[model samples]
Target: MKLPVWKEGLAYPQPSEMSYPGGMTRILAHDGRRDLLPFLHDCTITSHEGRLYLGWYNSTDAEICGSSLIRGRYSEDGGESWSEVFNVVGEIGSAEEHFVPASFFVHEGKLYSLITEMGGKNLSISLDLFQAPETSLDEWERVSVLSGGFLSNSSPIPMDTGDYIAGVWMPLKGDTPAFPAVLISQGADIAKPWRCSFLYDPLAPDAVKIRCPEITLIVQGSAVTAYVRNDEGKHGDLTCGPSFVFTSEDYGESWSKPARMTAMPVGNSKMFAGILSDGRRYLIYNNDQGYFKRGLLCMALSEPGEVEYTKVYKLFEDKAAELDNRVGVWFYPCACEQEGILYIACTLQEPDGVRSAVIARIPVDTI
Candidate 1:
């Protein structure tokens, strides 16, 4: 199906006027300097009861290199202030065993987390589900809520068929070139067999060099739309691709073939999509064409049921002198709405390549 094409990018106002007014920003986790195990990234945020929760991982060297540990923090006052950070998940990732990143979801009024673990005899990746009860927000024990097999960029959302659906990214292995797919949970229980809908085959000979997909899902009424991070750069003319779009009508049982959302610029990074309580659809991403890095974070919104996100916004950038040297690149936004504010948790990739987490609160009415 053909989707509407929106204009490319809306340049930021002079002196970066688009933010701090739209929302307030805060740096949640960071040491005075990049620590011994400095590399940190893949932050996720959500709202439950009346508090905000944030989670991320810190690696020893580069991503998936030495050891990576998952840490978390929370805010009771709507991102105004935060609790002390703690290791909600145990242990650090090693060469023989690895723990990459985590995402959050609320099911049956209870908060749950899905952490992707890349460990096995072959080091094959899988996702394990854990519950963080209301009594213990800072502490979460490793317990089995579901079997692990796929790696998802975000939390799953409840489907109309009394099920749950989430986007999964299968990395490249051997001749496989990395591909995107969706996992629709059977019934209301995610522990049951999930229907995996493979969008494209990574093993295709014509596949690009690398395809690191970060799937973002938005459910409006019965139409489940996916804004995928389609990082197809080569195998064609030299280029960097934008977010891909597709829809699932049968509650994610199946979906249309992925198609690039033209002009929706992005580097190889994660983007987030969700519908506000007021029904406006919003997307948080680094809408630049650069393939490796980005300048700042951006957001685009679509009026209820519109295909194109005409309402675009440039979020605030963390350009502080103390944070290394280069300008701050806010990437990988995971967001959820509470009351009327859209609380987005993201990572600030400093000049040195180490990362830290931050949260930006934006009210819907302000947009």
Candidate 2:
């Protein structure tokens, strides 16, 4: 089928702005330090009581401060307005806990917020759960913590009867360097312990680079996708690599082996995936995989079980011209779906040699 053209929306230089860059949307909140640390990572956006709630990580200093916990920011008037950014984990100055914010879901009228914490060998690495405020979007209470070292980039899937199935990133031990891992959790309450492991470790013949995992439980099917990079020899090198997909029937309990989505998994370094309002999948990351080459954000359509992909179109194929190497490049693509719209938020390696954030929106039907 000929996929519909995806009309890309405006990009934001800062989070909280009166309006977006292209004037197509409004910026809800800005971190104010555009040239310093970028705000939010592994972000999840959900609609509740007609307002949009965003839970993400505020990276004060990637190499120093670690991923600080940021609270939910709400917008009732669609994308026209936004609330002030709050902190999820109460005021704890310089706690030394790296919190990677993740998925949010509501079960039995209670809002559950999921985040990952990494505190080196001295600190515990696990998933932290918080309960949202009863009325106002002011405070979030700490509920529970899941044990594990590499519990990050989690996507929670709510089952039919109200139970939740969470797909977590589980780190593996090998010579492939350090990356995200894959884990699974199933329970009625948010505090219950769930099983976690590597989703797939298929032989790549070269290297295994899987990070930024996203899983979706859809109608008549189930699917999982992630951003992958082959930095075998180059540990921190960012280049377009390849993307892979796995299928499951029993609500993500067991996945159906791995399959390559991109034609070849050799050159690309990034391939961020998101399920659209129309069931089509969209991705944003580097496409070239070549050293120093620019990466383009793209969108595509896919059938849940089918291995072959279709409608690969570029959203932004421009090189990160303003990126500062000292601060790293503008990367890490994550998307959330709400009311038939896909909101994508990512970081830009700022010109001041720091990290900054940019967000954009697109209708699901447009893809």
Candidate 3:
């Protein structure tokens, strides 16, 4: 693999040397002798009606190459032990039709799985929602919305005005470069007919081409801060390098021009950030860069009700970790905070080049 085009110093305190959540449970592993879908990624977590559920897409080898299935597991005893694997979105998907697990959220007393349903219209995708009531996972009913061509990375967040904003991005369409975008709900309803807004004009005269994006938003009153993965390190420097950032003051109605997150070490990877149950802010993403980049997952936090992340912790590393296969890469982390427990689920790559999934359950007080 080629090294990162940009250079930034390693994180101040090394990740491997710090303490991680104790008894981190390995939810499930790919059984070569039994399973058909070997490659899995984009894990999402949410708790509904007294049960905790985690979901991800199990693909063939490359993403969106062939059929992809949304698989998952449930835990009744608060992340202590999880049930055997089961299908969340069992409909078959292919290169033209692919199902990527977006964040799972509950609204109006009903649990919903926001899916990035890709297919048709020459690789078009939309935020597809699904739900299965309390007694069964055998059937999931599809919920309708008034939108298309949008990719959802995280669940919707309620802003100060009772409205919600969900971090999303527009996929590459022709010469247009994909950039960070936002989807805002109207009048406290997270349903269809979203008002979409982009951080930058991708087709502008001086627009810089970027790689794929999964934006994360930090909301405070009328001020909102958004961050996205910088896979193409062509827009930043060693100082405020990597991670692209954008801000809004009127509840995501509009955004400022694209800029790098000031003086932070965040780099080319999908990150999860949100306000904790205790009013503190927490972020989960990979640390370091280059070959071992995604192999090191780290966490950062801020004081209660503060936006600045002053404390950091080394969450996990791909040491000789084995889950039916030697673990190597851990990426695309999605987190959910509930009942004072932070449930972080991520994709785990193995030595054979296939992938698995795991959820790290940590108490808020332990952070």
Candidate 4:
């Protein structure tokens, strides 16, 4: 297949020091001192019943200690403003456990939040459900803890057969590294049985090892495609590498061998793959040249079942020099589209090790 070339002659958005086009780059939450709330990352944004909901994980520091908890905020007016942050999971003295927000979406007229927990002898995934018509932050109920080794921050896509396919990854039992997998829901009831299908196993002798596989699924007709993150860089610089792609013809039951994507350079960070309201396939990722240099985040356009990207747009970039020279400026992007506008949520690390969660709004029609 021929790789798509970057679209030229189109007027791109003017760069700004503090904001992006439409002045939509605004900080939703931040920790200045790194003492009160140390780390804030893995942000996911979604619209539910006309309200914008932002969910992320926070801890005393950047570590996955017992002090980690899931936090959420709601925006009533299209993300122009937001409510005070609140704990979606975990408590003040819950030092022995960790609860991280994995995914949030509405399915079957019900709002659902997936929280992954890690504690002593316990590593499980749980579901929280709220009635769509009359749901509030206080109304969420822990429904069930999904069995098997399924964990991801990407939301599941509803299949034509009425089931949902969630992209997940698990650590290998022995010396092998982790790889991507699919969690097949039984039906509309998310609390029911879920079967697991391993897509790419790096431990196999013939398999291509993919580290930290943050798999995002995109459904096109009867086929489901995955863009797996190749976290490990080939040059040991943790920088430029092609993302691995896989497809499943029989729903999420089976998948094809992984292949390197063309015309796209993905960093060792997470990337998002989703369809726009206009039926165009888009991917948001860090198109940096070196490892941990997530300052350049770009969006590209592609067609269904196509490995090559046709057009590219610069969404945001942080040019400020890193104070410590060890940390990147941007990473962990999560996005969703509504009414032709794309809302992207990501974490911005400051020079002094402080991290803040920010969201950017881009008019999809302009791209």
Candidate 3: tens digits of C-alpha lDDT, residues 1-367 = 1111111333455554566755444444333335577777788788876778777777765676677667777788776667787776645544557777557777778877777777632265667667765667755767666367777778777776877788887777877677778888775555557788777777888875666777888887888778787766433333224677677888888877677653456757788887888888777877745523577787777778766666677655775343443567778888887687887887777667766666667888877
Q: What TM-score quantifies how close candidate 1 is to the native fold?
A: 0.86
Residue 216, candidate 4: C-alpha displacement in angstroms: 0.6
Candidate 1, residues 298-348, lDDT tens digits: the string is 777777667567666766465743333335677888888899888877777
Cα deviation of 157 in candidate 2 (Å)? 1.3
Clashes of 3: 0
| TM-score to native of every candidate shown | 0.86, 0.71, 0.86, 0.84
Per-residue CA lDDT of candidate 4, range 1-367, in tens? Answer: 3322223333333223223344344444433343378777788778777877788788765556647787778888777777777666777567777776558887865667766776522243343332222535743566776645455777778888888888877644457567788887888878875778889556678887766777888887677778888767655574557778788778868887776764456667788888887777787777756766777777777555454456666655654222223244777888888776788887777777777777767787666
Candidate number with the higher TM-score (2 or 3): 3
- Candidate 1, RMSD to the unseen true structure: 3.7
- Give the CA lDDT, 0 to 100, for residue 229 in model 4: 81
Candidate 1 or 2, higher TM-score? Answer: 1
Q: What is the C-alpha RMSD of each candidate to the true structure, in Å?
A: 3.7, 7.4, 5.2, 4.9
Tell how far residue 247 is off in model 2, in angstroms: 3.0
Residue-level lDDT tens digits of model 2 in 241-320: 44454555555556554544435322333334555555455445444445534334444445433333434444333343
Q: Which ten residues in a row have the lowest lDDT in candidate 2?
A: 12-21
